[model samples]
Target: MTGTATLLHHDGTEEIPRFLGAPGAALFGCLHRPAGVARSLVVLCSSIGAEWKYNYRREVLLARRLAERGVAAVRFHYLGSGNSDDGSPDFAALVAQARQVEAWGRAESGATRVGYFGARFGALVAAAASADTDMPLTAWGAPGTGAGYFRELLRIERVGRLAEGSAAFAEAEEPRVRLARGEPADVVGYPLPPELYDSAQSLVFTELAGTAPRDVCLVEIGGDGSARRAAESLTERGLRVHASRLVEDRSWWLHDADWRPDETRQTVRNMIEETVDWFLTVLPT
Candidate 1:
């Protein structure tokens, strides 16, 4: 995990692709540094599974935009995903890794404040990690409860099982699969641990109250009553919450094959613009 950070030059920015601290399984990160002094440092955490893959371009675009606005950004693959080494994937550990990257961003860019922006599953991770700190947060399309999210995950896995056929069933006969209580051995192409699924099975949105940051801007890709209610609850819990229902209707995770890339790109731009506008209003200039 301890290797020299390679500085790669990009348009009007410096990109450093490095392996973060791991004894054997190093986490991969690509830090985007602004050409001038940065106003703040932000860490981008991606959702699990297909959302992460589909929305990667959007994340890169946002990082570039943030750099242009004097915000240093780092996009990292969480443990067991992307270029990162394979390790046990759990929600709690992902949160800790995000915090570690946040600290790294503060040190690398010499920024005073560190903020987090996470999408889907990463939104939960961002919320959990930044709760004790004074940092601002932007959470997009976060589930109101863990059970709901877990159900969706299982459904996805079932579809994958049907597609993969009898070979997948044979794999399911393994002893650990039976003991894991229906926790997926793998979701799509991602191998999931039983502990990760168990942790997610009990996730409730209200639990975020215990570990919320001072300010949060809750965003939903499509309007949902549950998301709005979660925002209201957060407000009552003493955290400043701004809830908005964004009109980006493309479901990056559940869309059909006929989905248009141009439409998705536009939706991503809309989300990014909304988030940047909110950050500009609250974050110190």
Candidate 2:
């Protein structure tokens, strides 16, 4: 609800940057409008912390590619993350924000059909938000449960400490204790609020309410099979699920100094191509 300027791309698509939601809780986003009429709209939800930073370029590319194919896409930063407002939002709040973004994208583009495409932790948000809405969803490299993802953060912190010559493995639970004590802890340079930590521990994809959706496309990067069981669970619940795996380096987890975009060029291209193709088949024309 704040931006007013529109940036026109060479492809005749326009990128409109704006803030949505209430004044203090406004979320920053960019709307990629196609050259002419749009057939569908996609809300692109990003991962938190370093994943968000590393995948930022790919999300922009995905939006632009969708626009080129006559589809409108909206990419946004969750409240308290990225360019959005400064209030710490828990996992549930992030899910609500995703729903709000999808609604706003539909209204703003006048596109009757909408879909969600989320990466990493954002995949959890998309799955939770798509509940009962019957929208198509695509999750890339999603964890099976929030608790697992939270533990990974702690592992990363421990590794960092070890690399810095600090014997902190024995105190690996310090961050969890801090959160349990109603305090904030820093994880991989991002502040993790106690409320968010608590909510994350309770978020289980297989047990989420209203798990039904139009369909789901699960793309696993690095062939780790982390999302395989979750995809199978959705299938068991009678949801249409298509799952695939791609072997690639885990560039999303790398530090800025260690990340090299060229190495993952093929992976990014394949992901966007597959996502756009899948959306075309699942969403109403």
Candidate 3:
């Protein structure tokens, strides 16, 4: 096994199947427990979109690293996506999933301190899940709110089809149309669950600020130029925010992969590493 692969194996390993509390069925995944079960557990939620495919392996690798560092970690798919129980992908269920992960991580590992690492929609879900649950966030490219995130999606489609003129928006099948209708619409073949869309639009950061965390909430940005720029508004509430980028990862929803991904992963690796380091520094000893 490679050095990276060794971190996954632990002497007291326990398999908590379906432990992450995915709302539906496809949420089945494992929680790897290493020695320091009493420390902190990192629950990871993935970005919901095509970008998921690009970083799936990298996410697993980072989770494995967390296991090696003595923090038992749980990585699972949200409802409607991943292997978890598939459905129309309800946002509420997905948020609850993160809570379930935090709940289970504390219970199974005997750890009181829990941290969440969420990407894209997963990051939003993590934020919601952590609310009132007392978990701090280490989010990567989490959208400002459900509405902002939704707008970014439309921006991509709009920019891509601009040459098609306003005619693109004229079609009944257009994303903007489906969004207005509040139904599941395919975005490059990936189903955009309506419950997710409307619910996201219904939320704001203030509503998301449920339980206050200790101090800093670590945030990572993708190399999606305009998108990352927009993500900065997350810092508005005076949260001690650290901004960084994952170069190898591009905006997954864009019609054309307009980014250099290898550079993006470097940013992700640094973000994960620093997140762990910060966790060690800030988390009470």
- Top candidate, metric TM-score: 2
Question: Which candidate number maximizes lDDT?
Answer: 2
Q: What lDDT tens digits, residue by residue, belong to model 1 across residues 34-115?
A: 8887768778989887778877777887877787777888889988789888877677888788887877777777778777
Query: What does candidate 3 score on TM?
Result: 0.75
What is the lDDT for 264 in model 3?
Answer: 58
Write one digit per residue (lDDT tens) for candidate 3, span 1-285: 001122334455444555243233445555766655457777878777665665566567666667666777787766666666667757887787677666766776777677777776676777777776455667666666788877877666566566567776555377766767876777644778877787777776434643453344535454445334433443554444555555533343342445555335465567667777766664542
Ranking according to lDDT, highest score first:
2, 1, 3
**TM-scores, all models, native as reference:** 0.85, 0.91, 0.75
C-alpha lDDT of candidate 3 relative to the true structure: 0.62
lDDT of 1 at 247: 67
lDDT of 2 by residue, 1-285 (tens): 779799998889999888997788899888898888876899998988777877788889888888888889999898878889987788989888888887778887878888888888888888787777678888888877899988987888767767766556555557777888998887777788888888888777655522664688888877677668877788878888888987855444454555566336776788789888888898654
Each prediction's whole-model lDDT (CA) = 0.74, 0.80, 0.62
